[model samples]
Target chain A: MKKIESVKNPLVKRIKRLQKRKQREKEGLFVIEGFHLVEEALRHDVEVQAIIAEDNKNIPSNHSGAGISLVTEQVMKEMSSTETPQGILAVCSLPRQEKPLSIKERGSYLFIDGVQDPGNLGTMIRTADAVGTSAVILGEGTVDPYNDKVIRATQGSLFHLPVIKGDIEKWIEACQTKNIPVFGTSLNEGTTHTAIEAQNGFALIVGNEGAGVQEKWLEQTDQNIYVPIYGNAESLNVSVAAGILLYHLKLFH
Target chain B: MKKIESVKNPLVKRIKRLQKRKQREKEGLFVIEGFHLVEEALRHDVEVQAIIAEDNKNIPSNHSGAGISLVTEQVMKEMSSTETPQGILAVCSLPRQEKPLSIKERGSYLFIDGVQDPGNLGTMIRTADAVGTSAVILGEGTVDPYNDKVIRATQGSLFHLPVIKGDIEKWIEACQTKNIPVFGTSLNEGTTHTAIEAQNGFALIVGNEGAGVQEKWLEQTDQNIYVPIYGNAESLNVSVAAGILLYHLKLFH
Candidate 1:
């Protein structure tokens, strides 16, 4: 383990700025905080390049993740965005992206269109795992999966899932070719998923947080669904809608 | 607008520590910063004990709901939890018991049970307004809806609805006598709510972040439903589930 104490260190500055989308892309890495999350990364065989934890932090008093780094509370705070820093953060390789049209080897998969919030993206990932979705495809305009907030919000599930960045048009073509039925969520009637029987081999298309799926993507839908609402909220947050749809698909199919 | 420059000011100090829940309750008032949120609080008729904004630095913009206190950018930062303070915060009287459950009222209502995260609670409130849920009821162990983070996460919707704090058991009784249906979201039973059907009088009961509704609350359900999962996430964030259910309820009925 290495000790990093200087706030002025160039590597520290780079880690601090990883919160920004542009910086994330520039450095090809993002920050994941909290012990549970870092441990998940380790278990999944995801490459954790380095770690920074609080001074005098506990490490099972027995074993520790391979590349752990110790830092002063002040140094940890410098790299943290949360008010109560967890005293642990990891610099890890962004999950690799498979081809957009690529079919998952098994089970279910997810396709998100323009989900902009980091929390929503992270929550969707965690919920996807709960429902047994195989992989996640990020269509154009989706938020950066590597954003610090998104990583922390995923609650460590990020390391377990196959979340890939890709193009919607390509994804549609691929799913169609693979015989995977593509479903989309809509405010209009494409299919009433509640009653319609679900089958194996499928991927659901969740739209932008506000706009729904881009109008054109609806053309690819074998089933277009909507969760029933009793009130006047214009739409559900993207992640929530994805969760409901994803969970329903797994349960019924 | 009366300007407060001292960090020693009890109110300012209290506002700064709102990141911690214990401090927030002991102070009996939570801090709400930024123009949009404060504006929403004012519109909602939430009682404001004080106002510290940029323009009204002196003579504190005193009003019936709020004691006016004005301050400069530096002072505002001293009182804000956000890194980029928006030059304003109002110490509003914590809203009184939020449950406005009256099935006879013929509107959509939300029952949030132990949804722990403040952001999730706040986001649900924002989504509630978007979906037109009449009000929100805080079940046991639910995070305080008035916490600084929760208020901020509500966007401007914190001011749009009445969020009640109470025992759901009694509220369930009120709904029962009034003949309003009480529906709980769970991991089992009811058909997929692909299309939300809003009824004249119904309450949507949501549960914890990971676990669905508790057994006690589930017993009170007139209907038990679950959102579908098409992906790998294990569960939906409670707020996201609430948003989806709330929207679908309005869409179909």
Candidate 2:
């Protein structure tokens, strides 16, 4: 039970640095705050490097054997990204999947392209997890999945599934190689999503909030589909659309 | 054009006050920022009280007959809630519907119960709008629809439909009077969403992020339904869940 009384402590400084994308990537670690996320990381056997709790807060019993640090509330506040810092936080090693993704014969997959909003990206991952998607492949320009906002929005689902940053074109090719149909969402060019019957294995690509699935990616997809807008809304929220599409493709015909 | 050079100008102060829920309710006015939302407000023929634009920005031509005010960049920033003020905003008379909501024979409706997140509430409204829902009834404890975050998340779908703050019990009674099957989402006590055949006209109620729909409300519904979670995630994001349920109930038979 090491005590970090100052925000200037080396360990505290390192945790704070992990808030930045570059620092997280360079060090191959990220910080997760709040008791729920910290617990989930430990439960999932994610490399829990350290558990930091504010002084006087009881560390969970399961944290036994993990490195623990007791910090002052002020230090915890400095280390936390949220407006209200939860008493507990954890530093975990970033999960690395060195092997390239292999599209399975009977699973659903989500391919996200240039989704800029962290909340959207995270919720999409959570939805993909909820729908039992095999993996979530992030294309270029997607927000970093380890970003605090994205992790908080995922509500621990990030630990539950493989969320990989990969090249979309290559992933599409892999799906094609496996004879898995890939669907791209488009506003103008595609048939309604209902037109595509649910299948045992499929990949659905949802794109940027504004630009949508890139023209190049759409060209590579086996089929392009859209959720019909029956009312005056211009389009569905990207994450919401992903949920509908994932559930429909995974569970229904 | 009238010019508002000071943040303390009565008009600027009044507009800023509208950002608070109390002031908005008292004045029956809300402020919307950014070109897209302001343009949507004008296009939808909403009661535009005044258009506020930063000095030197060209106001859109569609703003012809509306009251227009030019403000300094500082003044515009003072009146805007977003970090980057978009140079344009509008003070709109809140759309007031005096008559009670009458559930139609062939229309879908969304009822939100105690959803606290503004982003979730707004996104759900947008989803309901996309699904051609007749109205979105906000139950007690739901976030204010006119809150800036909620309005931004709605992406102008707020102007496209009736978003009423009302009693959930009354709305459920109205739906029952019309014999529109009301579906309340629950994790513990519902048939799978797909278990019930989609209907042309129905009412769907989704609740808070952490808690499912309230027990009292769930008891009032004609059916309680849940989207199955096939993976390790706890549950779907509230807005995403609404999108899935709205699309499933409205489009799939």
Candidate 3:
């Protein structure tokens, strides 16, 4: 085991940089903290570049195969995004899905467009995974899935399923081309989601919390759906809306 | 209009104290910041004690009848909970519902048990409101709904519906006595949520994030329901799960 005792150490500095979107992209690596996320990453076979633990913390026996480094609590805090460092963290390679997803596959898909809140994005991904969706595609302007807040929100579902970033327009076109119905959420000029029968496979697009699905993409969807607001609320939380729609589309064929 | 230029002003100090649960309980007052929330409170006919705004900010014309106070920007920041003060806030009396909810009403109700996350609690309340739930009953140990993060997450829905804090076990007994079926969520020994037919009026119980509904409550419910997880994700985010169940219970028969 290697030991890193200084916040000034290059490895610690590199981990700190992973906090930013640009840095994560530049390095093709991101940080996962806390015991559960680290264990999930290893269990799911996410490439573990290194497992960093605070000097007083014990690394799990199964994690011994991975390259391990021990660091002082100060050094751990320097690399942690959370207020209280979890004492264990991992640097894992971002998973890449080289193949374009096939809509003909027998599973639902979630496309997030310009969702800015990390918690909302993460919860949506977890919901998608819970419903056994095929994948979660991040359209341009969607918050980075690797964002620490977003990752924490996913509760390890980010590793359980494929989360890819791609062009929204292209994914919509692809779904339409393959005859997989694409449903975009809208506040108006659409049928209620309950009116749509379940499908073997489909794509659902949810948009920015404030702006909703873009008009251009709504035009491209086979059908635009809205959840009826029976009360005085202006709108449902984006992630909650996604969960309701996803479950309906998946379970009600 | 009273002008409070000092953060130490008695009124400013009192407003600052509204941030704590203890202070809020003692005063029977809570602080709601942001332009939209203040507007919503007024629109909903909530008892507005005072409207506080930054010196240069324009108070809405319709708000002229309410008591208004002008504070220096620094003073506003001192009383604000958010990173960026929205330049306006309202100190409103907490609405008290003296009568216990009747389950015989033709609407669903949400009972939350020990849900600790403010965002989750707020979003669930918003979802319940969106579905036209009769009311939201917060059991002991649930986060204070008036907490600023919970209030913000509600996006002003807090003013749109009834959110009462009470005993979970008693609420369950009340529903059963009224012959209104109560649904408790559990991970085991429960039918999938879809298995239950929708009802005209029902009570749904969601529990703590880590533990499902407490065994005592689950044992007394009409039926315990589970949302089937089709993928490897351990569970849905609590708010998302509540959204799915609420929509199903309200929209389908």
Q: Can you write out model 1's per-residue Cα lDDT over B1-253, one digit (the tens) per residue?
A: 3566777778666667766768766666677787767766666677777777766532233345576666767777777888888777777766454444455467677889898888899888878876677778888899987777787777767777677887889888888788878888886567666644657778888888777688888887788887765443445677767766775665344
Instruction: Give the winner by TM-score: 1 or 3.
Output: 3
Name the DockQ score for candidate 3.
Answer: 0.87
lDDT of 3 at A101: 54
Error of 3 at A195 (Å): 0.7
Model 2 lDDT per residue over B29-91, tens place: 998888899888888888888888885455666776678888889998888899899999988
lDDT for B118 (candidate 2): 92
Candidate 3: list runs displaced more than 4 Å.
Answer: A1-6, A55-58, A96-102, A251-253, B1-10, B55-58, B96-101, B251-253
**DockQ per candidate, 2 decimals:** 0.36, 0.90, 0.87
Estimated TM-score per prediction?
A: 0.70, 0.96, 0.94
Candidate 1: C-alpha lDDT: 0.73
In candidate 3 chain B, what residue range of length 10 has the lowest lDDT sum? B55-64
Chain A TM-score values for every predicted structure, listed in order: 0.89, 0.95, 0.93
Residues B63-151, candidate 3, lDDT per residue (tens digit)? Answer: 74568889888988888888899899988888665456556556678999999999999999899888889889999899999999999
Model 1, range A1-253, lDDT digits (tens) per residue?
A: 4677788877678887888878777777777787777767777787778777775464323224556668878888888888998888788876554643457643577888998878888888887776777788888899888877787777777777778888878877777788878888897657655765555777888877668789889887777887654343445556766765665566443
lDDT (CA) per prediction: 0.73, 0.88, 0.87
